[model samples]
Target: MTDELRSAALESKAWPYEEARKLLKRYPDGKPGGAPVLFETGYGPSGLPHIGTFNEVLRTTMVRNAFHTLSDLPTRLIAFSDDMDGLRKVPDNVPNGDMLREHLGKPLTRIPDPFGKFDSFAAHNNAMLRDFLDRYGFDYEFASSTDYYASGRFDDAIRGVLRHWQGVMDVMLPTLRAERRATYSPVLPVSPKSGVVLQVPVEVVDAEAGTIAFQDEGERIVQSALGGLSKLQWKVDWAMRWVALGVDYEMAGKDLIDSVTQSSKIARVLGGRPPEGFNYEMFLDDKGEKISKSKGNGLSIEQWLTYGPEESLAFYIYREPKKAKQLHMGVIPRAVDDYWQFRGNYAGQAVKEKLGNPVHHVHDGKLPDGTLPVTFGLLLNLVGVMGEGATREQVWAYLANYVADATPAAYPELDRLIGHALAYHRDHIAPTLKRRAPAGVEVAALERLDAELAALPEEASAEDIQNIVYEIGKSRFGEEGGFAELRDWFKALYETLLGSSQGPRMGSFIRLYGVANTRALIAEALAAA
Candidate 1:
C-alpha cells in the first residue's frame, strides 16, 4: 500500500468510499495495467428486486464513482444477474403455480420481468437496476451468469477451481457447521428459524465443458447449465468467476457473508486471488425490520422508487453498509426527512467548496450531501403536507426527474429535502387515524381545526399557517399549553377525517390542499360524524 492509502485507511476507518478511492490512487495515474478494477454485484432472480438489492448496487457504485472521480481510476461496474441460479420458491403476491412453472429451474436472469418489456429473465431483473441507474446517472456493463458460463470466460479459472474442489468443500463445510449447522454445496438454503437444511445437488453433465444440472433435495430435476465447453461446482464457480471477471470489490448483506467467505477460501486454494474488497450491509424494512423475501415482508425496489426520491433511497442504503438493521415502512417519512436534511448539508458544503461561504443551507450543519450523511423522510412528508395538489405518483415523478437532472448542479440537495417532506405527508401524515376518539367526536375536532384555518389570511406561507394554528391552540387549550392541545386535536381530527394524524401542519395543509377543498373535506367529516 502507498503512504496515501495507508493514511486514508487509518484515518477514514476503512470506509468503503475512502478505501475504494485509495485503491485507484495507489497506482500511478490510477491504472491497473490491462486489468480493469471491477465493481461487481449480483442478485438472485427468485422475486421482484427488493430495496436491499438496490443497496448492493449503490454501495458498489459509490466505490466505482470514487475510483473514477476521487482517485481518477479507470474502473468498471460489472452487474451480474444470477439468473442461472435455481428458483427457491414462488414469492407472495405473485400469480402462483403458473408463474413458477414458467420460471422453474431457470436462472433469475432468464425469468421474464413481470412488466414483460425485457427479453429474458435476467434482462427483466437487470432492467429494474438499469432504470434505477439511468435515473441516478450511473452507467454500467450488465453481464449475466448464464452468458458468462456459456462464453468460456472462466475456462482457466474453472479448471483451477475443480482441481481444488475438495479443499473448497473442506473450508465451506466447517463454516457451515459452525454458522448454519449443515454442510451443503453452494446452492443450498438453510432455514434460519428451524435450523433445517436442504442440499441441492448439481449434476456434472460435461466436466470438460462446464455444463451442469441442478436438482432439489427430493431429487426433482430443476435447471440445467449446458457448458459451451466448461463448468465448475457452485463453490468453485463463485471463486473462479470472481477471478475471471477481475472483481475488485463486491458488497453483500449479512446473509451472504458466509458464502463470500467460503468463496474467498476457494479462490485462494485454486491459485486465484480473491477480490480486493468486501463489505457487509444491513437490510431494513420501511419500519426497520430485517427485509426478507421468504417472510414476504421485504419492500420491493419498485415500491421504493414509487414513494421516495432516488437520492434519498441511495443514501439510505449506502449510509452504513456494515450494520445490520431493519427499515420500517412506518418510519420512512422520518428517514426521508433526514436524507433531505443531509442534502441541504451537502449543498452548504458545495457552496463552501466552490463559492467559499457558509450559510443556512438547511438543518444547520448536522447533515451533508454526497456523503449520505443525513435523513430527510420527514421533510418529504412536509412537502406532501405542503403540496395539496400532488399525488404519490406525481411526487415520486418529481423526485425521480429532479435527481436525474444535471443542471442547477445543486438541485439534488433541494430536491431530496422537498421530496422527503412531501413523501412523509403522503405516506404517514395523510393516512392518520383518530387514536383516542370516535368518528363523531373527531368530526367535532375537524370542525374546530377548520374554524382556525378559515380565519387565516390568503396568500400565506407555511409559517403563517403555523402561527394561526398555534394561536387557535392557545385559545382552545390554554396559554401555556395550548399549542400542544391544538396540535393533538388537529392530529386526531385529521386522522378521523383524512386517516392520518401526520398530515401537513393544519394551517399549511389546508392552504396547500386549498382552503375550499379542505373545508369540503371537513364538512364531509362532520356530516359522517
Candidate 2:
C-alpha cells in the first residue's frame, strides 16, 4: 500500500473503513501464527435469496476490501447457509405448496425440492444464493450448516454446548417469552423414526457422554447430540459457529440486535469471542413496511438490475447503510445518475477525498471511465417526449446531434442506460403522463417562450437558454410572488408542456430535445388552451 493511501485509510471514516478498523483493534498483531482473518455472513435457505441477502455479502465484501488496504493480513469470507434449520412454514412465493406443507418441521436440506430441480428445498435455495453471489463476482467460500454437522465439523462445538447446557439456557431463557422459556432447549434432536427435527424439552443425562434424553411419541429416548444427530437452536447455533469457525467479523440488520446480544453471551459460555459488527437499519418497501424474503414485498435484485446498472445498486448500498432507506422502483433513476456523478467526481478528488468517495468503495478503488454525457432523468424525459414508439435508433439520433461523435459503440454504459430508460419509461412514466392545456398567464408565457426559442442562435448553450428561461419566469411571475412563483412557473411548464409534475432542467431538455421540438410542444399546449 502507498504511504498516502495507508495514511488516508487509517483516518478514513467510511463505514467499511470503520469496520476494518475494528478488526485491526481485535488482532493487533494480525492473528497469531498467520491464520487468515475469517469473516462470515449467515443465510437461512428457507426462502429465495433477495436484495437483503445481496446487501449483506456486498457490504461485507466492501469491508473485507477496506481491511486489505489497512493490513497485509490474509482474509477469508464464508457465506454460511443454515440449511440444517427446520422448515417452520411454507414460504408464500414458492411453488408446490402442498409438497412443502407436507415436509414442514423437517430440516430444510431433507425436504423434497419444491422446484423439482435440486435434491432438496434448501439445496435449490443455496444454489440460488451462490449463483446470486457469483453473478456479482463476489469472492467467498460457501458453507452449509447441514454439511458441517453431518461431516463432524461442528461436533466439538456441539459437545461444548452439551457441557455448558445450563450456561446456554441461562443466556437464552430471559430473552424468550414465558411459554417459550418452558420448552426451549439448546439442542434440537432429529427424530430417527420420522426424520423431522423435533424441538422438545431435553434432559441432559450426562454432559461427559454427550447424551440427552427427550420424549418422542410418548417414549423417553436417549440420544447423543453429535454427528448430525442434533443441531443447536438458532441463538446457540450462532455462538457454536463462532467458536468452531473462529469468525472475526460479521454484521446484521437492526432487527437482529437482540439476537446478536443473546448469541454473544452464548459465545462467551462456549469459550469464544463474539465477532465485531454493526446493526444496519433494514430496507423498507414503498409503503414503509420492512421487506421480507417470504413476503417478497420489496424490489428484487432482478427488478433493480432491469432498470439500472449493478454499480448503481452497489452505490445505493454503500451510502448511509445505518440510515433506513426505501427500496423501490422510484429510487432507480436517481441511483443510476448519482453513481456516474460520483464516478465523474472521483477523477478530480485528492487521495483522502478519494477514500471517502463511494465510487472508490463501490469499485474497490478501480473506477471506470466517462461521466454520462446526459443524465438519466434527461433520458427519461426524452423518452417521455418521443412517446411509446420511440426506438433506440431514434434516441441515438437525438444523442448524436446533442453530443457530436457519440454512438452506442463508443459509449457502452450510455447504451445500456438507454435500454434501461426505455424500459422505465414504458412501464412507469408513460401511463402517468397527462398533458394539460395552458390557462390564462401560462398560455401567454408559453407563446412568449416559443417566440424566444425561434429567435435563439443555433449555437446557444444550455446556460444561455437557461438564463432566458429564468428571465421569462422572473419577469412573468416575480412581481406577484418571489421564489414560490418561479417554482410554479417551472411546474406550469412541466404540467402543460411535458404532461408531468416534475422533469429535467428546461435548458438541458430543450438542448437535447431540439429547440424546434420544444417550440412545437409549446404551440400544442397554447392551441389547446
Candidate 3:
C-alpha cells in the first residue's frame, strides 16, 4: 500500500486487524527464532464443505492479510481437516446412507468411498476441501488428522495429553451434561475386534506407560497412545491439534465457542497455550435458523459461485464478522451493493474508513482492478425481464447502449454479473414470472407510452427516460394519491413487462436496453395484456 493507505490501516478498528495486532504482540520480535506465524482453520470432513467453511477460511485470510501489511514476518495458514474422526453418522448430502452406516464407528479414513472414485470417503472430502480452497488461490498449508496420527507427528501432544489426563478431564468434564461427566475420559480407544473407534469405558489409565485399557466387546484391551491406535476425544483432540501444529490463531463459528473454551483449557494442561481466537457469528438460512448441513436448507459454495463472483461472497463476509448474518440467496444483491459502495468511497474516505472497508482487506490491501458496470440487482432484474434464451452478447449489447463502453475489457465484472444474472433468472425467477396483460384503458396508455418512447431523441439519459415514465403514470393514472399512486403504476408496468411487480428503475432499464427495444417491449406488453 501507499503511505496513505498504510496510515489508514494503522488507525482503523472496524476491520479484523485489531485481532492481528494482538497476534503480533504475542509473537513479538517478528516470529522470533524463524518460526513462521501460523493461523489454522479446521474442517470436519464428514460432509461436503459449504459456505460456512469458506466464511471461516476467508475471514482468517483477511486477518492474515492484515497481519502481513503490519509486519514483515513469515506467515502460514493451515487448512486442517479432522479426517480421522469416527463416522458417527452419514452426512445427509452424500450418496449412500446404508453403505456409510455399514462402516459406522470406523474412522473416516478407514471407510470405503461410496462413489467408487477416491480411496476412502475422508480422502474424497479432503480432496474436495483442498480443491475449493485452491480454486480461490488461498495461501495455506493443508493437514489431515489421519496423517498426523498415523505418522506420529502428534505424538508429543498425545503423550502430553495422556500424562496430563486428569487435568484435561478437569477442564473438559465441567462443560458436559451430568451423565457424561460420570464416565468422561480424555481418550477414546480403537476397538481391535470391530476395527472401529469406540466410546467404551476406560478400565485403566497408565499415563506413565502412555497407554489406556478400554473395555471392548465385553473385554478390557490396551491400546498405544499414538500411531493411529488411539486418539483423544474431540475436545482434547482440538487442543492437541493446536499444540501439534504450533498454531498461533484460529477462528470458529459462535456455535463452537464451548468446544473452544474446553479446548483452550485442555491446551493449557497439555503444556501449550491455546491460540488467540475469534468466535464469528453463524450464517443463518432464509428462515432465520442457523444453516446446517443436516438440514440441507442453506446455500452451498457452488450455488453462491453460480449466482455471483467469489469477491461478492467475500464482501458478504466482510459486512460483519461478530454479529450474526444470513447467507441465503436473498442477501447476494445487498452484498454487491456494499462492494460497490465501499469501493466507490475508497478514494475520498479518510484513510481510516478507506482502509477500514473490507474491500481493502478482502483484496489484501490491493483494490480490485475492475468495476461492475451496472448494479447486480439491476442486471438481475434486466435478465428477468429479458425472458429466456438471452445470450451473453445480447445482454452485452443492451448494457453498451447506455454505458457506451461496456466492453468485456472495461467491465469484466459486469460481464460475469450479466451471465450469472441470466442463470439466476432461469433457475430461480422464471418459472413464477408474471406477464400480466394490460386491461382496458391500460392498453391505450401503454400504446401512448410506446409512441412517446419511439419519438424520443436519438439519445437520452436514464433520468430522461424515467421522467417520461413518470409522465405516463401521471397522465394515465392521475397521481393525486401521492407517491403511492406513481409507485403502483410503475409496479403494474413491471408486472406487465418483466413478470415481476418490482424491478430495476424503469428509466434506467429503458436507457440501457435501448429506446427502440423498449418500445417493442411496450408493444409486446400491450399485446400480452
Candidate 4:
C-alpha cells in the first residue's frame, strides 16, 4: 500500500501498528511472494451486533480493501460465528435452558438458527455481517466451524494436535497463572486402540454407541464419536482452527488478547504453521461493564443504524475500535456526518499534502459542517414545526440551507456538505428526544404562562425575554450558551411536541424555520393552556 493509503487508514482509525504494516508489505509479496494472504475475524452470536462488531469487520475490511486496491495477488478476508461456543447463559428475549440445550457442546455451525430463517446458528451470525458488508462494500469470504470440521479440514490437524499436546500445555502455562483466566485446556487426539492421548493425565472411557470420552485432571470430561471430534476444547480449538485454515491476519478485542496469545503458543507447538500476523484491537465500552447478552445494557449496530447512515457507523468503528469508546444514544448520526466530512477533508489534505490514501482520489464522500449539520434533533424540530410530518427530502433541504450559510468559503460544495451534515445528524442525533422542561412551564400551559408573566409587575419585552433567558443560560453554560440554550429549547420543544427534548436552537432555528411558523406552534400551546 502507498504511504497515502497507510495514512488514510490511520486517519480512519485503523492503526498502522508495526505488525500490521509488516504484514501489508511482506505476506502478500514481500519475500519471494508469500502465500495468498488470508485475513479472518469472527463474532459471538449471543446478542444483537454492536458498534464493536463493526470495529472488528471494518478494521479487517480496511486491510482487505487496501490489498484489493493493490495488485490483487489473491488476498481474502474471512468472517465466522462462534455459534457452537456455548450458550453459557440466556440472552435477553431469547429462550433459556433446554431451548438452547440442543446447541450445547457443539460448534455454532451445528446449532439451529434461533430466528429459523437461517439453517444454523453460524448462518444467523454470518448473515448479520453479510448484510453489513454488502452495504459497506467489503470483500470477504464467510466461514463456519461446523462446515470446516465437517469438511474434513480438521482430520489432519487433529492428528497434528495429538502429536504436540504436551508442548501446547507448556506454552500456555504462563497464562493460566491467574485464576480468573485459567480456562484453557489443550486438545490431544486419541490413539485408536489405546483410546488415550499420549501425554496429558487424561482417562479414556468407552460408553454405549461407539462414543469415546477423555477426562482431564480437573475431572472435566470431553466426549467424541467413533469417527469424529467432539472433544477438542475451545482454546486449543481456536488456535488450531486458524492454523488449519491458513489465516494470515486477524484483529480481536483486548479481552481476548491473552487467550489468543496462549492459543498462538499451541499453534507454534503443532508445527508453527499459524496465521503469520495478528493485531490486538482495543475494547470499546471497556470502562462500562461488558454488554453481555445477559445485561441488556449495551447498544447494538442496528440500534446505531436507526439514527443515521451505515458509513458513519463504519467510520466511528474504524476510528476507535481499539480505543475505549462509548456510543451514547443519538451520537451516531452526527458522528457519521462528521466522519465523512473529516474523511473528505483528510483526503483533500492528503492529496494536497501527499499523505493519506491514494484511493481517496477516487473515493467520494466527506463530513459535514458541525452544529449546522442536519441532525435528527434538527429534523425532529423541523417536523415539530411542520405539525404534520417531515420527509427525508425536507430534512435534506434544511441541511442544505444550514450548510449554505454556515460553511466557510473554503468549502464550495455546500449541498454535498449538507448531505454529509445530514448524514451525521441522522447518525448522532437520537430519533427520540430528551427534554428537561423548566420546573413549572409547559408548551400547553403557555397561555397561563403568558398570563402569569404578564400579570407580574412588568411584562418582559421581546428584548428582555431574550436577554433574560440568554443571560441566565450564559451564566450557567458560559460562552457556549449564547447558542446552546436555543438548541436545548428546541430539544425541549421537540420533547413537548413529539415527546423528544433535543433539537435545533431558538434564534437560528426560528430564523431558518421562520417566525410565522414559530407563532403557529406557540399559539397552539397557548390555546391548550
Question: Highest TM-score, which number?
Answer: 2
Residues 1-529 of candidate 3 have per-residue lDDT tens digits of 4676556556668657787887878877876589999999998887777888778888898888888777778889999888888988878887888999999989989998887789999898888888889988999889888898889897777778877877887887778799888777777778889989877656445666667787787887877767888777998999988887788999898988989988998888888888988898988888889987655667888898898778888888877788988788878777777788788777677767766777777777668666565788788777776778888888887887878687888887788888788888888788889788877656776787898888888777889888988887877665443334667778777878777867888888888777887787788887776
Cα lDDT of model 4 overall?
0.53
Q: What is the C-alpha lDDT of each candidate?
A: 0.55, 0.91, 0.81, 0.53
Ranking by lDDT: 2, 3, 1, 4
> 128-238, model 2: which lDDT tens digit per residue?
999889988999999999999999899888889989999999898988899998999999999987888999999888877778999999899999888888999998999
> Runs in model 3 with CA error above 4 Å?
1-6, 203-205, 348-350, 439-448, 472-484
Lowest lDDT sum, 10 consecutive residues, model 2, at: 476-485
RMSD versus native structure for model 1: 8.7
Task: TM-score winner between 3 and 4, please give it.
Answer: 3
How should the candidates be ordered by TM-score, best one leading?
2, 3, 4, 1
Relative to the unseen true structure, what is the C-alpha lDDT of residue 339 in candidate 2, on a scale of 0 to 100? 87
The per-residue C-alpha lDDT of model 1 at residue 509 equals 51
Alpha-carbon error at 400 in model 4, in Å? 9.1
Model 2 scores a C-alpha lDDT of 0.91
| lDDT for model 1 | 0.55
lDDT of 1 at 520: 69
TM-score of 3: 0.93
Name the regions of candidate 2 deviating beyond 4 angstroms.
479-484
